[model samples]
Target: MSAKRICIEKDKKTSDDDKVQKVVINSLDYDSLAQIFMLLPVPERIDIEGVCVKWKEACQLSCLPKEINEIHLFFESLLDQKQTRSMRMHGSSYEASRELSAEVLYTIFCTCKNLKHLDIVHCRNDVAEIPLEKWISFQNLQYLAISCNMTPDLADTIVKYCKNLKHLRINNRHHIINTALKTLTELENLECLILLNCIKLNKESIIAISNNCKKLKRLEISIRSIYDPPSSLSDLDEISKLQYLEHLKLCIGKSLKDSTIIAIANNCKNLKSLEIAGCSAITETALVALTKLDNLQKLDVSFLHITDSFISKLKGLKELHCDFCEQLTEAGFIQLIKNNPDLKEISVLGTDSITIDLVIAADQATKHRTNGIILHIRKYDLELTQAFKSIIKSQWLVVK
Candidate 1:
């Protein structure tokens, strides 16, 4: 309690502070640092490497895609007498009272400097709560899939900060205005983009994406539902501008038709995967047009008016998803399967002719093959589906 005793204590505290300051991240060996890195979120762990050379090396060691753990330790041995606290002191903290995971965003932006992939889609935190413009720090972010109310400011923040973003997906929210979508198109390096079910996304937005993100390879757009989009009538023609497109999924109701399919076949020569689901206007002619694309490996014309004639024409397809084509006969479906020798997956989920007999017959046809075929049957087929698991196994996805 004396002044002399207090001064001695103060000197001791100052010495401890100096010791803490002297201890750098490189002071720890890779194994010890890697152990600590393993405890952080995967993105943060990957990002931590950007902190320093030692951390980067430790990160690499920690993320080895090997079969087993590199280090084996005795519990008692690991509990050494020395104990140390982490140097990171002035960052985000956890508290249950806060409903939004907005804190998670702040922590990542400030701490995880080298984050590569960020998929907070349908996240509990409304990113609108975070001032993304102010906290714009995703310098190394390559992939981002988020669901937030798409304000112009939010879109601008993404376009500005997310320079390295190669893949971008904004889903589920409505009335994503064309201007706002245009703002996001500024991400020139974008290779994969998904903007589905955005009612306000019309021709203008599509044009913007095609114009700006020239590097885009995979594009999925669904701006129209049963009714037309709120903006101008959907411009299916503008899609041809994306000459580099390799994979495209369109669920834009009537906006996707035979002409669009034909244009895609002619322009997007590299098109590999094409899905035209929930489009009522598309006739079997669309299938004929799609057959022109030599690189097309996967075709999904689910809920379309595809018949036995057109479905049989499809050959060498890796995957054929013709879910709920009520017009398709058992014989025709079998022929379709027989035609595609390389077919790995044929999903006939809701087609009326997908009977136990049809499945059994298909299994019998494809059973003796070296590479297995996956048959997606209805949930009611579970009993027989399970029975077929051991022999002539169809990788069944029992859909409702």
Candidate 2:
């Protein structure tokens, strides 16, 4: 056999199409190898432990080929296992002793240029300061999620490197300011941005994001506080600039007004999905404006005060979630069943006032159709939390 054919056959046995289809990488095994496995599309098909063991053996035996693009080996754990060089770690939770070092992370970035997605969740071990010169290693990275203990400087370093990033989710417990968000503006291709439990992002940061991330299509924001004197919901104007936006989630626990909701409905006309949970300012006015949006398919207006009039107007809605809407009693719910013939899923997690009779009324209103109804409620009624569930079970019998 020819030399080339023999080499090809040997590599072919390991690179079988099926094996390539089933590769999963988990952290408990070779953390570095598992990361590399994540770069593969078929990581879900293969056994995660098996892939890690294989990579561990490959690294230990120094058997890794230089041209291997499918496998990513981030040896930060290995570097920590054997301290080589100093690496500056920036996250809030820094447990990696001077022994683990940042060289491993640096080395991985340098080698894995094809990394398309990167998730650094709750792992921040920076031993010494690494120069920015090494930051441009992971240029192809597209999806990046850094949560729990995000570092501001580290976030800048990542944005500088991953300029082509599409989805960015960062949760900074240390309280990041407008600077970090401004830095993210450079990622022109960013599509999905999530800032969950971030204590520092105020209205200014929100405005900056609206002005800069023009291409953003999906956003999840959790603001610490909203003014009680009923600050005008003018920040939505910034959101309106994002014409291509499809999904938006706003968790602002402040006194909101009807004008704010109207402003949002008018501006974010392209919104296919919307979630406004725990915003006490919203009322039937907001709900009324929302129904006018012909494109809205899924809506979650939980923990808000909506009356029977608003419930009756949602005839065009497909999926509706109204959990903990204390004011939404059986009268409003029955109105929803009677008015919204196209309704598919209804979630009433804490609307305890709704009884079994109301459920029957709802099912009857729907022409006794059981195929399209999926209700989520509690199992018992003794606890305050169980009311919604009991109501759902009682309603289920009526549907049949």
Candidate 3:
């Protein structure tokens, strides 16, 4: 039951002589509320304004139940994990989402002293940049993915104290300049770095990461040339410095070229998963060159131009996402489905060639497979969707 309902139920048993005593209980005195809260077997979310407000406030003071060590707010699969919904109603002890304000965050930081992983992607930007001083309370803070502007204070605090931080994702920040990156160089143990929609990704900044973060294994960053990226084809060779790099995704719209892909294939030989979308500058040769990555398993070339020849050339790929590839016809993908027996997933959203017939064809081709192949497509018809709900997981490309 909710904390509010608990209060109402507890009210019926209170004695009339305990009226003043009940005021102390109703007002939610810190010590009294904490004691009462501990007595309850399983009190639900204390997200309320009444005595439960004191219950939450008391949780901040007591810091007893450090069970909740993770918080996911406005979070979804970055790509290829779960494409069903854009927004997830997720939180701790509460399934509904709440405003990720400084006060709410402070309460969480103070309450869950051992919070290890926090993902606040798609949070409101109205609040001021989060004060990193409050973050010191998290003794076990490791994975932090947030959408906020990077400031000197934020960078300095991260460089100084956040030693255990492993996976860090900063999205839609315009201040990821060379200075901020220089501070991050202090985090030598950093393994995974994902910079989504960072408008200031440039040659110098990219070089700083490639030159310093040699231990990096996964890197996903968007290249915005309007924010000062190099125009030449060979400007991205610095990416080859990370010999340990396994998974790499570059969101360069029109600036990505074939030479850059070739360099990554030649240098980052251990690359297993590679995703490049909106790279209109390169030819189908880029897809053909990716065939050189022997370890490549997952590939996402969404919103790119590719023909039947390149699609046929790519072999041994386990997962492929070719959403909006106008030239990727039904015959081309079915051939791919029949060839790669170990193929796991294939997304053809926004492709005109996909139909019920193609779905039947793919199912028939993979009938002898050990593990089933999941097909992803747009939610075009409700009746049709209901008909194949078990076979096809209908994911809407345009999320609400």
The lDDT of each candidate is 0.67, 0.61, 0.66
What is the lDDT for 7 in model 3? Answer: 88
* Per-model TM against the reference: 0.68, 0.66, 0.74
| Weakest 10 consecutive residues of candidate 2 by summed lDDT | 92-101
For model 2, residues 200-301, the per-residue Cα lDDT tens digits are 555666677889898888988786764323354466556767777789888866534566567668877788888888877676766798877878878888
Which structure among the candidates has the greatest TM-score? Answer: 3
TM-score of 2: 0.66
RMSD of each: 10.8, 12.7, 8.4
Error of model 1, residue 179, in angstroms: 1.0
**Residue 15 lDDT (model 2):** 86
Residue 61's lDDT in candidate 1: 50
Error of 1 at 60 (Å): 24
Q: Per-residue lDDT for 347 in model 1? A: 72
Candidate 3 lDDT over residue span 121-214, tens digit each: 6656422255667666665778877776676567777777677778888875455655676677567778898987755655667777888888
Score residue 331 of candidate 2 by CA lDDT: 79
The global Cα lDDT (0 to 1) of model 2 is 0.61
Q: What is the clash count for each candidate, in the order shown? A: 0, 12, 0
Q: Put down candidate 1 lDDT per residue, 232-267, tens digits, no spaces.
A: 444666787788998998887776666777777778
